[model samples]
Structures are given as structure tokens and as C-alpha cells.
Target: MHNSIERTPIRAHLTDHMVIVNAQAVETGPTRRPAAVLIWSTTDQKIAFSDPKGNLLFEGKAALVAPEVIRRLRTTDSTFFSLNFEPGNRHFLPLSRLVARQDFMPLKFDRFSELSDELQSRFELADYKGIEELSDELALTLLPRTNAKHLRDERIDLLLPLLESNQPPELNSLAQMLHLSKDRLSHLFADDIGMPLRSYVLWRRYRRALLALQSGEKIATVAHRVGFYDHAQMSRTFLTLFGYSPSILKCPKFIRISGIQSN
Candidate 1:
């Protein structure tokens, strides 16, 4: 049997810290993924998840695959578009809801055609900044009004850039700077973000590692730059987070939304 090849030209757009990739596959292929993925396909693509030994776990058209899932794809030529979310970002509210479930969650929505059209146009035109603006607006609308004090105290909105930087400020230092006790700092992070601070740091490091690897950096260089102890440590973290070693990863081409100038 011939390997299912990615036939159509694949394009990616980054918006709201999410990477959306559009591709059409001509046949079935086996591949490993490192992060959680949500697929919205124009057609019901035949997708499957299996164990390392290839035991089928799930199959469907639309899937929400958790991090480190080894999946096999089997499908005809179809519009298979997917979004890769940066972990620990609560802004991905719609997609985050599915994280608590199994690695793969199948979905069916009749309105997918309309949604796909809008998304396809945006990606094709590389309108990521527009998408980011809309997402920000939506996030503001959804943010809880009761949490004004929390927002002010936590300052996540302001600290996001620092958090994403190569040298993330330590929580202890941040706590002292903000005049919050360590316990209060921890509580605030958990309460507002639904994740621990250390976990958030790890996710950020992993995110940077992925981006660096995509930019054609060597594994050791990426590991060091992202604050890992070494390439081995980074590889271990990568395997744990993505279910595949970085060696097997083939980074996709993407247009970073942050790189685009706002219109």
C-alpha cells in the first residue's frame, strides 16, 4: 500500500497564540504528534488514534487529540484543517474545555461548512492579525466581570510578554515585586489561570522549543535557549508532552501573527 501523501499545498497561520494549518491528504499515513490538536475538516476525514503497537483507540472526522498521542490517519482527498493550541493559555476557552476528556474527542457540527469558509479565507490571505483582534474582543466579552480585582492583582495581561520571554521571571521574585506572599501568588495563579505557575513555565518553554525547532535550530541549541538542562532533558520533555521525540518531528511552515503588522 502506498503511503498517503499530503497532496494539497499546506499553509499555516498564527493567531491568538494558536497555529492553524490547512492541508489536504491524498491517502493514509502514520504520524506522531507532540501537542494537543483540534481538527475541523471540510469533509469527514477518516482519522484514528492507536497505541504504539497500533491498537485502534478512536476514529472519526473531527477529533480533539491530547498531547503525546500517536495517531494514524486514513482518508481520501479532503480539506483537513487543524489548530495547535499553546498549552497553559486560557484564552483558548472553547478548545480548553475538551482537554479534560480523552486524547481524542470526535465532533460533528452541521455549521462546519460556514465556519470553514471563513477560516479558510483568513488563512489563505494570512489575516492573522485580524483574527487576533477578534479573538481579543471575544475574550474581553467573555471575561468574568466579578474578577476585576483578580485581573488587577494578577496582571497576567501585562506579564504575558514577560512570561513568554526566554528568561521568564521567577514566581518568587514576581511575588516579592508584587508584594504578594508566595502562597497568595500561587493561589492567584491557580485561581485565575487554572494551572500552576511551574506548569505554565514548562508549557512556555515547550512552546518556545517548538518554535525554535521550526526555525531550523539544532536540538541542543533549542534546549539550551529554552532553559532545559540539555538536549536529553528537552527530548524527554518533548516525548512526554508530544508523544514523539523531536528527531521525528517535521516542523510545518507558518506565518506568525505577531510578525504581521496590523492593518
Candidate 2:
């Protein structure tokens, strides 16, 4: 059994809500709805991704994944690069805006030339510091309309840290923290971040669970630690997000380019 394969975490520049990862998965199997700007280094990669209703969202090399859906990869052993935007993350609005329209959007390869080049040239040869520097550079380049200040949302800025806690704040409690009604907060969250509060919360929990499992924590322990009801609950979330059981994280080939600290 391949258990908890290790790879150095890819360090990214600190930005509220945006996530960047440069990872390589070797036959790592299918992944769930990843909310990020996913650029795979493969030409004409056949992908069959869909919403919960099974509606086809994309079939291409690069696609922006919105939170809370299920998608399948057609291949493994490929370089996977992504920049995910969360609430309080105003840096990648162009990418976020695309995810807002639907579950996923097919992107042209040229959209990520610098990131792709860096991944190819330095990903294998670079040391941790070099990867960290490259990741910072990549994050800077991914900002949309770099000259304009990101559209800041104080509500989300306050909300992100809460979402990272072991027990996510209740929506009503979160709204109270932001001084808004739950309904109003939900609408604004969807409007600004392009996904509902519940979905984002689920995705955040799912991410924590993945990292924990990868670190070799037992499934039950990870589930409880990350605020899932149980191992089953965590597994369900994984199934919902990755279209596979959480055990896939246990795969011998599983390789992670860790995103920023969430635990």
C-alpha cells in the first residue's frame, strides 16, 4: 500500500483568499470539484467534468473549477498547476468571474505561459527556496488587471480566518460577525466570491481533510479533527468533491504541492 507519499509543499505569496499550487500527480486518480484556475501541462487532455446533475462543463487542457461540484480526470502522471481564489481573495477576479458564470470554464494554454514555463524549467530542479520564490512570482503574475487595486470585500476578509478554524462558524453566527442578516450575507458572499458560503465552507473543510490524510493521520482522526461528523461524513464530502473515496489520498502515487497553511 502506498501510504502518504511526500513532496515539499509549494510556498505561495500570502494573499487573502487566493491559492496557488504547483503539483505533479502520477496516476493519482480522479479529483473532485477544485475551485481554482487549473492549468494542466498536457495538450488536448481529454477531460470529462460535470456538475452534480452530470451536465458536461468542459473538455480541455485548462479549466477554471468552481467550488462544490464533481469532475473526473482522463489521465494521471501530469503536471497540475492551479491558482484558486476564495472570498477575501480579490486578486484573480478575471478568473473568479469566469467560475461565477458556471461550474467550469475552458481556458486557452497561453493564459498561463509564465506559470507553465516556470513549472517546466524549475519545478524538478529547484530547491524549496527556489520553488517558493517561483511560486511567489507566479502568484503576482496571476492577478487580473494588475494595475487596479483588487476589489476588496471586508466581509470576506473577516470570514476567511473563521472558515479555517477546526469548527467553522455557523452561517448565522458568521453573518452576525459581519453585521448582516444571514440572507444578505449569503447573497453578498455569492456575489463577491462566486460561490455560496456553504459550498466554500465545505471546500475548506475538504482541503484540510486532504492535507491531514496526506500527513498520515488516520481517516477517522482526520474527519473529527477537521470538523466532519465522522469518517463517513468526511468520505462523503470527498466523494462529492473528487468523485472518489477519500482513500485516494492514501494512494502510493499521490503527490501534493501543498497550498498555504490551513490547519
Candidate 3:
């Protein structure tokens, strides 16, 4: 018998604060995830997660992982679904509450199992809106009473737009505009956004590049337009944010993206 795993196209639904991904037999090496994520196996098959030293961490049907956790995922032949929530997402605070500031937390998969078939069918049919609705339902099921208030800070709100431009303002200038010292601004941003200001800026640039790529622009053009130093730099950033290289886009047959937009 052949020992190779048969891989399928990766289907993903992307929004400013959330991303839903479905894939089969995909594996990732130890890497620090930039956002909190909920993962479950669609086939009722077991999935394994390990630390950087390859020490067994968890082997189960579902898991909730805190952001910045360095771990490896071993899916083997199982189909899996994942929900990634950005730090600033409204659901993030609630979800983080579940993790209790830990690296991993096992989750009951009863709800996920019930909806797995329908979610898989929707992805195959390219029903993005349906996918979004169903994913939201799953999220609510996992985190009940999730109608939490959104994080708001006028200073961070003002800083967000400045970071969108190809030539974002320096941190010193941004603090000046906010009428605060740079140290104060940095602390405020971290407290409000749940991430460092510099990291968020880089994530914004990476997101802009993804949107440009979705429009079928050349890598070099997208890199330049998104404020990356060059193609090589952009590729490196892509790999850092995503476990895979940006070259994976070359195989459009193996990738499907929907509802991707700028923040």
C-alpha cells in the first residue's frame, strides 16, 4: 500500500477579525501562532499537537490554543477545521477567557461534530455566505452569550488608519498625533489591541498583500504596493504569518478563498 497522504485543496473564508479554514491531512511544524485558534477534526479522527521539542502536548478531537504558542500539528489522514480569531476580535476576549492564559485547552466537540458535514458540503459548493453563517453559529455554540462589547479606544482607532497606508507614519509621529508620549502610546495600544503596535503594523501590511494577491496581481507588484521591501521580504513575512510559503498560491486548484477583505 502507498504510504503517502492524499491532500486536497485548502478552503478558507477570511474576514477582518476571523478566518475559517478546512483542510485534509495537512501538517505544520512547530511555529508560533499569531492569533488564538480553535481546531477540530471533521472525520472524528484524532489530531496531535506537540511542543517545539516534539513532546506530546495533546491528542484529541478538538483544542483551543492561545496566541503565540509554539506548537506542531499532526493531522495525518484526518480532515480538520480551524477558526482563527485575531487579537482585537470581539470574540477573542471571551475565547481567551476559556484558555485562562494557558497554551492549550481541550474542547468538547459535540457541536462541531454535529455541523461538520454541513460545513464541509458548503465549502465544496462554494457557498461562502452560508459558510460564514454556519461558522458563526459554531462559534456561538462554543462560546455562549458572546455578544460582548467591542474594544474601543479613540487613540488606537486613530492609529489604525495611519497603518493602512503604504508608507505608514513612524511610531514617534503617531504618538505625537495622539498627543501622548511614545511609551504611553505603546502601552495603551498593547492593552487595547492585545498585541504590540509593531506586530500589528506588520500584520496589516501582510493582510494588504493578501488582498492584492487575491486580485491576481504579481508578487513583486503586490510586495511593492503593500510596503514590503521586496518579493523576498514579503515571502518571508507570509511564511511567518502562515506556516506555508506564499508560493502555494501558484496552485490555485488546491486553494479556495472567499470573503477576504481589508481591515
Candidate 4:
């Protein structure tokens, strides 16, 4: 069976230190294991993923930790649907660290509660192919606006230039362009974006890796293309930041790999 595949969402550089991505797929496919997000709660240490869902798989909604969390579970056979979200706010989560498997507390926003009653009633929202456009609007608009904070707004501004780039940007250069020292950038990044500068870079690198894999390039080739010295480094980075090996994902189905880990 084939599903219509749109390019993945433009990687987001949120000022809120929140991470959001949008994708859609049928729940059944190969081994279906790929990278996973490591969400650490800067406040509590155990962060939670939104529930696995869709009329495509099971009923209602469920939550899961993928690639890395599952790997740590030592089982390779289980599969589930997932969409990633890690957010930080002082009044809300008050998180200080962004990371993978961080043992921070798990947090979730009210599901349909945020959506209108009409949209909420549509229980069987099939696949991402169906809802990605709406999801993008939410990620760019609703999610950032979720926590009204100046720090988060600044992080979005910091990401503006990198988002406009044709390739991965040198963080230092981006820092210079923004006229802040790397150390200041680090503080501002965590304050404004909720994640450290390095974590966001890794997230962008993996996004490129997903594109390369989807286009039929070798992981090693994609690794080099995205600034890793080699496939091994990429793999290691994937393991550390995302919780899965680079080899786990197939072309264009980056949905298999999940979550955004804040450094």
C-alpha cells in the first residue's frame, strides 16, 4: 500500500524551548523503529509524550516513548503511533534542562480541549497526510503562543535566520550575526528557546538526515551532507540526542524517529 507523502514540516526553531514536528503515515510498516526524542523536564525530570493515536491504529489516545526509550526497554518488536512535544514554561513546567530520557516529569496539553468542539468530535482523523497543514499552523502559531513569555519570543527570533538558511548554520556565526557571544547565546538560547543552542543544531542535523534518507541517499552520505564528520558520528549523535540509531529510519518516513530533545 502507498500513502501520499508530503515533505516533512519545516524544522521549527522555537523561542519557547518547545519542540514540534508534523508528519503523517499509516501505522503499519516494516520494523518501524527509528530515532526517538529524549524529553527531559527541566523542572521535574520526567516528561511525557502526547498519546499515540489515530483511527488508523487503535482507539482514543495513548502515550509512548520511542526508539531510545523502547530500546532501553530491551524489546524490539513493539510498535506504536507517536507525535512529539516537549515544552517548558515557568508558570507551567518551569523546566531547566532539555534532554533525552531525562527522567523529568511527563507533561501533556489538553488534547481536544485546545481544539474547537467541532474538530474535537472528529475521532478518526486518519493520518498526518490529512492534518499536516493544520498542524503546521498550530506549531507555528498556537504552540508558541501557548506560553506567553518574552524569552520564548526571543528564541523564535534567534531561529529566524537559521530557518532562512539553505544549509546548516554555524551557531557561532549565527551568534555573531545576532551580535551575542556564544556564552551569552547559550544563556539566551535556554532562556528564550527553552533548549540549548547545541541541541537545536542536532535537531536540524537530524531533519536533514531524514530528508536524505527519504531521497534514497545512504545514511553515511546523508550524515556527511548534514555536517557530521561521518555516519558513525551521526549515528552516535542520533543515539545520544534522539534515542535511536541512524540506521533505523527509512526514506521519508521520519515519523518512525520521534521527539525533540533539548540539550
How many clashes does each candidate structure show, in the order listed? 3, 3, 0, 29
Better of 1 and 4 by TM-score: 1
lDDT of each: 0.58, 0.60, 0.76, 0.40
Summarize candidate 3's per-residue lDDT along 66-141 as a digit string, tens digits. Answer: 8877778878778899988876676676676677667788888786888888988988788878877876676666
Whichever of 1 and 3 has more lDDT, that candidate is: 3
How many residue pairs of model 2 clash at the backbone? 3
All candidates: TM-score: 0.68, 0.69, 0.85, 0.49
Best by lDDT: 3
Per-residue alpha-carbon lDDT of candidate 4 for residues 64-137, written as tens digits (9 for 90 to 100): 33332322211111221223433233322221222234432233434323442322232134333333333334
lDDT of 1 at 132: 50
Top candidate (TM-score): 3
**Candidate 1: C-alpha lDDT:** 0.58
Taking all chains together, the TM-score of candidate 4 against the true structure is 0.49
Q: What are the clashing pairs of model 1?
A: 34-242, 68-242, 68-243
Model 3's alpha-carbon lDDT is 0.76
For model 2, the superposed segments whose C-alpha errors exceed 4 Å read 1-34, 42-70, 76-80, 86-88, 91-93, 99-117, 120-122, 125-150
Give the runs in model 3 whose Cα sits over 4 Å from its true position.
1-6, 144-150, 214-216, 261-263
For candidate 1, write residues 30-67 as lDDT tens digits.
45543456665687556555665668877767766665
TM-score of 3: 0.85
After superposing candidate 4, which stretches have Cα over 4 Å from the reference? 1-80, 86-158, 163-171, 241-243, 251-263
- Tens-digit lDDT string for candidate 2 (1-263): 11224543322222335445555432223455535554455434444454445456576667667654455443344455655555445434555554666767666666565557665565556444555555456545544554565564776767777888888889988889889999999898877766788877877787777667767778898898888889888887776654457776545354443445547
